[model samples]
Target chain A: MEVVLMDILGAVVTFLVAFVVGMTYGGLSRKITARVQNRKGPPFYQNFIDAFKLGSKKSAIHHGVMHHFGPAFLMVSSVMTLMIVPVLTHNQWFPNLNFQGDLIFLLYVMTFGPLGMALGAGQTGNPNSAIGVTRGLSQMVGFEIPWVLALVALMIQYHTTSITGLMAAQAHSGTWLMFSSPFAFVAAVMAMFGMFRYSPFDIVGAPTELASGPISENGGKYLFVMMSSGSVFTFAKLTLYVDLFMGGADNLLILLIKTFALYLIPVLYGVTTPRYRTEQAVRWFWGWPSFFGLLAILQAVFF
Target chain B: MMNDKNSQKIVDIIQNWARKHSIWVLAYGTGCGAIEIPPTMTSRYDAERLGVRGAATPRQADVLLITGYLTVKTMKRVIRVYEQMQDPKYVIGFGSCTINGGMYYDSYNTIKVLDKYLPVDVYINGCMPRPEAVLSGFAQLQKRIAEGRANGAQQYKDNLEWYRANQKKIIPNWIMPDYNW
Candidate 1:
């Protein structure tokens, strides 16, 4: 009973930390984007205000049961992913379900939210929603090839399918995987551009073109849940990358620094770039990122 | 003991503050006044600093900015958009055009009085308000929101029949979803 209670408390703490960090990162990105464009942006806590306002809104319309459940589904996926991906290394308070073969499970759990969103968007009977869902799924397919390949390369090189095992390998070797397996890190970071869904790869929710796409019909509380879930998912994905490449962090501050450093790759890149069409984005992913993934696999096989 | 009424008042205070800060405007660019919006949102003005941002759809919007003169044909669409928006929404009558049709005052198709058709929270009087004026207009709306007096959506709901009657007179074919909310 004590073990179960402690685990529950740990999970809650992990989620709260992830939520706060991720929301702050989101706000900072907005501020950075504004400064880049020569404009004074909203406060760093703007996202928090938006989330609170959204939650307080009265959601009067929902197309169906699926529509109502969409955000809940997303929340579940993100929280589940957060649980599987260990936040801190060798910490008693943050030990969140780090087991063998969890890396494989993580990949599957990450994509689960979008499929659920697709169903919810489909039920809205909006053509734009349908188009956005298809575009998002296609983009997912585009990035997954290189992403999965990079993970497979890491697994092969380290001889372990678990995230904790890989982290242990880095600790034992005294060099981050980013240094040792540079090719895989490069490929994965490239794939991270699409995963983060920044400007060039943000066709899924193309506001100018698709009227905000899959989330067009969702507002009020539904939007609130989706936004919060997105923040949580962002932190989980960033933490996963840190654990895989940067050898994981020993403390909260170090974890944040590494994750934020990794995060800048996509945000800064997106700012200078223009939006790519669906096919163009897919091809771009398949081109260089996939090639890097192949190179990473080859390097793993050879050395 | 904290009673239900006190708790409700506390909730209302927090909600009003949030609504005041984050104003998502769905710009219904009905006339030439639409030209000013790009500058207002972009580098020169930067309405985002004031928590005033553009929303893509009616569902996500909080303020409906009716920019310029609304013709009979466009009013129908405008009303449809307004009705589609969730409650606690505000409408800004942008420019002299929206206030009283501007240069198109004598034009046959243009709406002379926007308030007769829909509840408007703020009116910016200019041939075409500059980005500064637009920001000022948003600030005015924000002030109204903070005072809990921006009840345009509620007024529209309460006086639905009068608004509907006015709307139907201009629009020949009245086929729309009932205002159930």
Candidate 2:
């Protein structure tokens, strides 16, 4: 009972932290976007404030009973995603959560929230939203297989699924996983980055084409909850990368540097690329590097 | 019995105060005025010092700050969300969208005025109001609340017909968009 209660508490705290951190990125993106367009943007807390205000308002049940559960379902999955991910060392909230097995677990757990959202969007019966969710899901189907294959290679090479354990192995060998098998690392990094819906892959929520995509129907409180979830998911993924490739650093400063360096890759890529059509993203997901990802598997196995 | 009454009274007082000070704003970024909300609430203007926070759940919010214009589609969902919020709530329409239609004034979908659909506590005027304008609107709202002049939830309840009528005028199809279908 005590452990269960602590887990809930930990989840809540992590959720809040993720929300704030994620919004900071959103604010940062907005600023970056404005600079690109030669405009002065609002402060970073803009997304935060927007989400908070909307979440607090009275939740109206629009589109009937199923819509009522949409926000609740998304919120649950988001918090659960935090629970499954290894956020802290010494395992602050969930002691059972290990870095190794948790990575694979993280992949599966994260899948549902988006699926639920796509379903909810379909329920809205708006052709645009339905089309958005369909495109988002189709994109998901194409990339997820290659992404999983890449992860499988990582697991086979390291001989562990625990994120912390993988990092520990690297520390002992005086090498990072990215160095051992650059292709796998690249493929994994790209897949994860694409998963974030940052440029080129932002088809699911394409404001231009789909009007905020699956969440087109959401407004006020519902919209805030969704944005809050997006925020926490970002931090969680960033932290996951840190654990996977750059853990075992002694002090906070080195860890921060490594983490930020890892994050910059995604940010730079996001800022530079134009949006990819659904078909093009799938082709990229399945075509070129994904084929090399198999060679990465062979390299990890034979070497 | 006395303690219960006192507790009830205390609860009422706190709720009333929360309703006023911590007005969580949902400035849906559908227009230019959406940009002004951040400065009005962040460090330079610091709306937080007044207890106003941007919340993520409707159950936790007391006020909905609709920053600017709403299209027919956006207004439909906005009305639905507004209805979900608990009573004793207030709505503040920032910039010309809430007052009149502003730039989208002649647009077919944009509501010429917000009060036509929802009860508005304050009407902030600016083509796209600046942070200062939003702050002034917040002050005006606070004043009205303090003076017992603002009765949003009560008015909404006591005059259901009026509320219904107002929403009907703005939301072309007073029927809530069925997202569940």
Give the per-residue lDDT of model 2 (tens digit) for B1-181. 6569888777556544544554655555677776787777555676654555564433334677887888878887777766656544678888887787888878987888788677888888888778888778888987887665778766666676776776676566565643321
Per-model clash counts, in order, read 0, 26
Off by over 4 Å in 2: A1-16, A62-66, A91-96, A99-101, A248-257, B1-181
Evaluate every candidate with DockQ and list the scores: 0.84, 0.10
Q: State the local distance difference test value for candidate 2.
A: 0.70
Q: Estimate each model's TM-score.
A: 0.98, 0.68
TM-score of 2: 0.68
Instruction: Please state the error at residue B127 of candidate 2 in Å.
Output: 11
Is model 2 an incorrect, acceptable, medium or high docking prediction?
Answer: incorrect
* Candidate topping TM-score: 1
DockQ of candidate 1 against the true complex: 0.84
Q: After superposition, how far is residue A200 of candidate 1 from its true place, in Å?
A: 0.7
Q: Which stretches of candidate 1 lie over 4 Å from their true place?
A: B1-3
lDDT values of the candidates?
0.92, 0.70
Give DockQ: model 2: 0.10
Provide i-RMS per model in Å.
0.7, 8.9
Model 1 agreement with the true structure over A1-303: per-residue lDDT tens digits:
999998888888898998999999999999999999999998989998888888887778869999887788899999999999989988878868868899999889989999999999999998889999999999999999999999999999989999999999999999999999998999999999999999899999999999999999998788889999999999999999999999999999999999999989999999989999999999999999999999999999998
